[model samples]
Target chain A: MFDILIRNGKVVDGTGARAFLGDVGITDGRIVAIGPELQQEGRRVVDASGLVIAPGFIDPHTHFDVQLLWDGAAKPALEHGITSIIPGNCSLSLAPLKADDRKTLIGMFQQIEELPPEAFTQAFDWTWEDFAGYRAAIEPALAVNVAPLVGHSVIRLWVMGADAQQRAARPDEIAAMQDLLRECLEAGAVGLSTSFVDVDENARPVPSRFAQFQELDALCAVLGEFGRMLQIVPEFYDTDITIARIDQLAELSLKHRIPTTLSPVFDNRQSPNNVPRTLARIEEQTARGARVWPQMQTRPIDISFSLLRPSLFFARLPGWIKVLRLPVPERMIALRDPATADRLVADVGEDGGERLMGRLVVRGGGEAPDHLVGRTLGEIAAERGEVPARALITLSLENDLSIGFLAANGGHDSTERIGPMLANPLVHIGASDGGAHLTSFSTYGDTGYLFSEFVRKSGALSLELAVRKITSDTAEIWGLKDRGLLKPGFAADVVVFDPQIIARGEERPAFDMPGGGMRYVRDSIGIDTVLVNGEVAWSKGSYSDSATGRVCELT
Target chain B: MALSLQRRFTTPEPDESLESLAARSLPDLPLDVAMEHIRGWNLHIFLMRRPRGLLLGGDVVFIEPPQT
Candidate 1:
């Protein structure tokens, strides 16, 4: 008898083929049969009428490394139909780290993830210091499959200690790092991850950024031995530099005979040539039989911030950063001072930040007034007879510096332009940055947004192709074994969703993190059921107690 | 297929100073001229980073100008 049966759904098999009505049978945590009207008995059954059943989505880039310790499902990620996730991207993971280096790594995590300090201290036990120990700690309660990447920074730290961030590794240190990486690969790490552009909480470059090219090359040699992937956060802001990094990745890929990927290849109005030029380089490199995949997110960039803390949204504006970096009491004094306010306003340019701050909507769920919520700063500024910059300061001072504001679609907003790019076979649809950027924006629902905006709304890609992009394509790119198909004997990781309405819900605040830390989250709209390894993990707006997830096997 | 050339760049050797890197990357020019060219071509390193011009081992120091 089948363990479970999903009946009469439109099966989009993650193969870029046409969908057809079918039933799938599951047993022993794997798909046992998939055909028309599976004539079988089952212990349980799922009615998937009028829904689409596809292979579970794979998110290639995430920082769920620490979050996975407490919330094994990665919270709303599994609810949004992401069954298998690749965490430990961007040169930060929570294992192979010495107990002495824990504080240092926590500072880096705080810098990138913005997770509260209590999350580390209050959430779970830190018993593991090596890759295998870390894996063993989280494996028992997992409800979503994980294919983790060993971090280059942590490996450097394991070998070179404090000098990991200070100088280049010596030849002996590099050899030691190779041995450590080999151990991690054997311990079920799917790949290696490094970063070129991340900094610690103190704004110093992270350890991975300090490594010389030879260091990265030596690490890649270890990865080549295992045929694992190499993921990097390149200098994506600059086109010339990103192209250079691509050339470097291609050379490493060809030389080591392994696949490589870079996150966040964005298309922006300011640098319109970034995507096209990068894709051009990728094509040129791929034609030479080098694997250099560029990852791009489907969702437009949206950033939310308030004056209660220093946020990177104000990064380009030096005066705001300076004032915000001050202590809270002093910062309030600076914002209220006429002389300081005048200088700050003047620094925003002659238009007084209208072009930049005008469209920022006053997000509610904070100290913002009922009437001010959902209203744009431009509109409020006109009513108050002040420029947007001055109004922003005044409004925050009035609200005790707790007013939340959102700059929606700040960049990568051109769905009309991005559609074709996403459809480009060479472009890998990922870089969600999920489980990081928790407070800044909702990183939970890029997959849902892909369906709603791109497939249903813009028709950029057909349903079958979009499924293939995030499923089989992602699985094939990362060398995940047997988890991205609907064939018999494949892992029964699947999602049932309404094709016409599957989407991300409105962003809202959730105080669900350890220590009740608040984060912006989006509810899944039309996902009906999500299955991980043949067990119903999320069904009809609820999570199951079944912990059927395991560490993914690599090819 | 032959990949088209990108802007030429190099990473820093261990504890290498800018003057030394300038000497190594642009050997044909005089020291002062090579340093000036290096500064001009790599604004992200020379201008943008805090403690400006503080070189690191992993920096992608551009040796020539932007191709376009």
Candidate 2:
């Protein structure tokens, strides 16, 4: 008997092919047959009559490295049809870490990813000092497939200890890093990731950035041996620097013969030419037989933050971050101090933050008055005859600092402009930043956003093409073998959803993290069922106890 | 797409000295002139770097000055 049968659905195979009526048969965790009206007996049947069945989506960039320890399903992501995730991006992972350096890496994660402190200490046990040991720790808990990349910073830490962040590596140290990277690849790491942009909690650059270019090249040589991928987070905000990074990646790609990717490539309306400029370089590189993929997110930037935490929303406002990072009583004292308040007000810019803090709407709660709940800070400030920054501070202080604010559409929101760019063959759709940035924004549902916004709304990509981009295209890029397809003998990871209704739910706070910390999340709108490796993991809007996930084998 | 205007560039050769690399990358220019131009173009190495101008094995050292 067939293990499972998904019948009578519009099967959009993750190959950009036209959607057609078909039934998929799964046995022993692989797609055994797929054709029209298959007559097959099954232990369980999923009646996917009007839904679209496609390969489970693969998110190439994420930081589920920490979250996966506690929540194996990478919650809300699995519910959103992300069957496979490639974590350990941006030079951070939990493995290859010495017990002594765990505090250092934890601080880095807290700083870069904005995860709360208890996420590391309160959630799970930290054992194992090697790649294989780390894998063994989380392998059994995962309900979604993982193809983890070993981080360069951790590798450096493993090799050089604290000096990994101090200076250039000597030749002996370089050779040791290469050997360690090879060991990680041998232990099933998909590749290596480094960062030129991230800094640890101390505002020092991450260990990878401290490495000279020669050091990176040496590590890439190890990656070259396995033909593994190389991922980097470049200086994405600057056009010149980003292009320089692209050129660097192209050179590495050519020299090492490896696939390389840079994440979180954003397009702002202010510079419509920016992405085009970047993509043109990517094309130039590809023409010369170099693989350089730029990862872009589908959703616009929306930052949800409150005065209660040190959020990335206030990252630019060092004064605000300083005040928020303090103990509550000290924070309250500083906010109430007249001299500090004046300086903080002055720090908002000469116009008193009309440009930056003008559109901030006061979200009423805790100590906020009902009248100011939906009003802009500008309006309230003008009513009170105070600068917007001052007004924001005074009001928050009066209300016990319980007010929340949202900075919506910060950038990457130009649908009319981004549609064609997202549809471009060279542009890879990714950079959801899932499972990190807790309380900052929701990184879930980028795939659904691609369908709802790009496919149904903008007509930039058809349903088939959009699915292909996230599923097969991502698999092909990452060299994930036996996944991202539904052909016979391929892993039977699949999702059934109503394309018309598939979308991201409204962002809301979820108190699911350790220490009861809140994270911003969006519920999946139309995903009905998700199957990983032939077993139904999520069905009819709820998750099953079945843990069919495993560490995926890369080609 | 903007082209990389400065065509004369080479990766550093095995901990090459800055002065040597400057001369090798800009063979036509006088030693001092090439060295000055190299110093101006590579503040990331000469100015901001911890050990200024300590060239590595994989650096893309540009010989020509700015194009724009």
Candidate 3:
């Protein structure tokens, strides 16, 4: 007897083939049959009439490592129909750490992923030190399957201790790292992830960046042993450096015969050819039998921030970031002091922030006045007869620091330009950074946006092609076995949603993290049901208590 | 599928600093004139990223004059 049967739906199977009317039968957590009519008696049956039933989306980039320890479903991601997630990207993970190194890892996560310190300390018991133990801890609680990548930074820290970030590894250290990587791969890790551009909380480059080219080569060789994946974050700002890194990755991929992927390729109107040139290089390497994929996100860059926390807006401005990073009272005092405020305004520009701060729109949030909402900083500054930067500080001080600002469409805003690129066959549709960049933007609904914006609205990609991009294409790129297709013998991970109405919900601040930390989140719209391992995980805007998900193994 | 449609151009060698690079890539102008044109052309880098004229190994370093 089938465990579940989803009947009467348009099945857009993940193979990028055309959709057809069908019913799917599940048994033993696998799809046993898929056809026009499947005569089966089941323990439970869902009437998915008028909904599109397809393979659950696979998100390729995320930082759900710590969150999975506490919220195993990965919350909003599972609700959005993502059954499998690739976490530990950009060289950060939770396992293979000594107790003493907890603070260090916490700082890195805080800096890179914007996770609060209490998330590591207050949420879960820090019991594990190796990849196996970390896997064991989260296995029982997971509702969405995970294909985690062991981080290069964590591996270096495990082997070389504090010296990992100091300099290039010697030969012996490199060998030790290779052994550790092999152990992680065998312990259910799907790949190795490294970063060249990320830094720790102290602004020193992460340990992975300090490693010479030889160290990474040794690690890639280990990945070759198991036919696993290698992911990296290159210096994306500079196209030349990014292309150079692509060449380096191509060499490693050719030598080791392993797939290498990088994120994120942002579309900048200022540098029109940046993304195009990078993709061209990727193609050149692929022609010579090297597999290099560049992952791109569908969402435009919209950053919303308040003085409540350290934000990406203050990233390059060290003085503002330092003050924002301080405790509330100290931060307020620093902002109030004339000397510090003068330095902050000076940092904006010699024009006293006429250029940098003028474009920020007053987004209403956290006790902001209704009058100021939707007004630009430039208008407010003109009213006050002061420069935009000075007006921002003066206004915030008056409001008890409750005002918020938004920098919308910082780049990647032109839909007409981005639509064709996203629809390009060679472009891999991902780099959502889901579960990271918590405060800056909502990464949850890019998959839904892919359908809403690109498929339905813009006509850039057909429904079937868009579904395939996030499912089968992602599976094929990552070498995930038996999960990304709706067919006999494949895992029964499925989503039922209305194609016309699917999109991200409104972005709102949710204070659900440890120590009352807040993250901007968007709920999923138009998704009716999500199933994992043939069991309902989300239905009708609520989650079931089933934890049928396990760590996925790459074959 | 054709991957991209961008024309790739390489930065000239060292001793071929910005002036020499501009003169060679845009040979119609003299050295000093070419340098000024190059500076005016690529303000996004030469003006934005600090140490204004700091050249890296793999920089785009455009040689075209400013767009009017």
Top-TM-score structure, candidate number: 1
Residues B1-68 of candidate 2: C-alpha lDDT, one tens digit per residue: 33444234565665467778878888899999989998887665567655567554334456665443
Of the two candidates 2 and 3, the one with more favorable TM-score, higher being better, is: 2
Off by over 4 Å in 3: A305-395, B1-68
Regions of model 1 farther than 4 Å from truth: A305-358, A364-375, A378-391
List model 2 lDDT by residue over A31-83, tens digit each.
Answer: 99999999887788888898999999999999999888888899989999999
Q: Give the TM-score of candidate 2.
A: 0.84
Candidates, ranked, DockQ = 1, 2, 3
Model 3 chain A poorest ten-residue lDDT run: A363-372
TM-score of each: 0.93, 0.84, 0.82
Instruction: Order the candidates by lDDT, highest first.
Output: 1, 2, 3
Best by DockQ, which number?
A: 1
Compose the digit string of candidate 1's lDDT tens values, residues A174-243: 9999999999999999999999888888888889988888988999998999899999999888999899
The interface root mean square deviation of candidate 2 comes to 5.3
DockQ of each: 0.81, 0.20, 0.06
